[model samples]
Target: MTTSFAQVMIFLGLGIGIIILLTAVFRVHAFFALLIACFVVGLGVQMPVAAIINVTKQGFGHIMQSLGFIIVLGTTLGVVLEHTGSTKVMATYILKRIGEKHAPLAMSITGFIVGLPIFCDSGYIVLSGLNKSLCRRTGISVVIMSVSLATGLYSVHCLIPPHPGAASAATTIGVDFGRLILVGMAVAVPATLVGYGWARYAGRKFNNEEPGQAPVVDLSLPTPSVLLSFLPVIVPILLIGIKSFIGIDANKPVPDWAGLFMVVGDPVIALAIGIIMALLAVRSWKKSTVSNLLQEAVEKAGGILVIIGAGGAFGAILAATQVGQHVSKVVNLQALGIFFPFLLTAVLKTAQGSSTVAIITAASIVQPLLPALGLDSEMGKLLAVLSMGGGSMMLSHANDAYFWVIARFSGLDMRPMLQVYTVASLFMGLITLLMVFILSLFLL
Candidate 1:
């Protein structure tokens, strides 16, 4: 079951090559591509054929078991917010309070908070109309607002839990979810600020054109109250954070009130509660409307679920190959510290254009090396999780779906899109990694 260092390198190369060829060159769907990569790695590492099947099945099942309810509930909450105009209400409220001069910052904050529950793509689509409105009103370039919004969404999507990428990475690496959330928030704030800075500069330089008439959007829907709109996201975060504070353990005696928080504070249950709150926040809660929204959410969740499961399978195969142990013997990753995970994930992300896949695979690769790398403590593992997230933020270019979403929705030409959003992603990711490194010195 042991792999030689040379065999590990070859397996790594073959695995990554298959992923790039299938997903990048042939345009195979990422789910199938990751599954294929898993099988290839399993075979290349000399796993028995029957064991490969069992490993793949177990890996896929394990990830889905950990992530299925969280992803589904999170997406459903987002769907309700988007379909019911709650997202818009929050966006509009933030813009009005911040006024025109600070619209980019406002949008950044909106994207950060909203992104906790919604996927970045859906969050961008939900808020694009609002972004357009802000541009027209403030005479700020759509480029700045778009980049700011994208940066904000990207920040939380990669780092924050219940966002699938972060959640799966945390789960895969066996980090505490609540601690990851806290650390992710710590890193996200500065990274988002870096993105906001880039957005402001890009707005002034590349998009100084006079604003045109804003596109017309339906304003007749009854929006949820601001407090009600925020409850879904805010409550779960608070509950989970509280649980982290109390330190749930069987060894410790639990009070009754603490027991209640423990049940509600579990990530799955908290998100499920958020889903119900989101459903209630909808202005008209007709059964048909609810049914349709659930269907749409499920459809979106299905694609993400498969990709995550496949990524898990891929990681499982890597572990089976004992690549981590081989790499540990060959490389002094302890010297590189947190940067090792970040660099590995950045390469995967830049190559394959999926942050979730990058995080999952990187975590799998790093999990077994934790002791060798001196990242075996809870704090160290949390840092590793955040490091992978930081890496996933790098180089969001043409191959990235989010790149196209910002391009098409924001009406940015290819050149400016590269300059603004793409370059900004690089900056944000680097700044985040730097921040994570600095924090690790103190915490780890």
Candidate 2:
């Protein structure tokens, strides 16, 4: 059972290489790929077969227990918003308030807010029509509009909770979910704006043509009012934020109302409240329509849940090797500090192309080394989680499904997308990392 640090490190690298090979090169499902990688790492590290299975199961179950309900509830809210036109209503409301001259900024803000409850790809799809319509009406290049929206969505998906990556990473790294959400939202702002700026410049330089007419939306259902449309997203954030603030100074005597915060402001409960509010968007709550929509949300969340669970399994197997302790003694990765997680996640993301997988794996790999890297403090761990989130945003390219979602939906050719959107992703991630770094100086 004893293995050299070099041996363990080699096996770890091999296991991750297999993940990238299966997922990226062979197009294997990440769940299966990650599971396979887990076994590879476990067996290579000389773990007993039964122990590997038990650890894998425990890891997967742990992640599901902590983060599963939140993901499902959040996905349900997103599905309800998408199907019921709440997403469009929010977009239109923002556009009206911001005016056509500020269309890209409006779209960026819309994507950021809407993306908080959903995956980036789904968020982009839900808003793509609005992006196209705005591009046509405002005479801004579609590239600008699409990149603006895509980057906004991308920034939050990588950082904010209720999105699988950030949630799972928070669970793995032992960071408070509410605090991560608050910090992530703040950090995401600069990244979103930087991405927006890059989009504007790239649009002018690339001059990509607009897509065809915006797809006609089904107008059968009454669009929800702007306040109702925003309620689901806003209420959950406020509840969670209040909980975080209440807990900030633990020495302060717990207030009598803290019990309520403990109940409604828990991330899972908050998301459940959001789902209940989202149900208001349904015009006719026929059992059949409601059932189907809930089913669709489950189907969407199912894929994400399994993938994140497998990532947890993969992390567990790696953790079992105690490679982090070994690596810490050999190399002063502590010196790299925050950049270590960021760079590691960036590599995993660029290689295998799933931000969720990248962040989860990086969190698993980094967890044991937290003490070694002088990041074992509460705030330090959060910055590490955010650092991984920042790294996961970079270098999205042809392999990323979200990239294609933006390109095809926005009518940008591959080269133009690579030039504008892909490049913008780099800057967005870097800017986010920069923000995290700055926060680290103050908080850490």
lDDT of 2 by residue, 1-444 (tens): 898998898889998899889988989999998999889889998999999999999999998998889889989989888878999999999999999999999999999999999778888887888888778788888888889999989999999998899899899989988899998999999999999999988788655486744455664567788899999999999999989888888778868979799789998889988988888766567788789889999999999999999988988887889988899889997799999999999999999888988898888898988988878999999999999999998789988888888877787888879988999999988998899899989998
- Per-residue accuracy of model 1 over 258-295 as CA lDDT, tens digit each: 87887888988988888888777755666776788799
Candidate 2, poorest ten consecutive residues by summed lDDT: 212-221
- Give me the overall lDDT of model 2: 0.88
TM per model?
Answer: 0.96, 0.97
List the pairs of residues colliding in candidate 2: none
- TM-score top scorer: 2
Q: What is the clash count of model 1?
A: 0
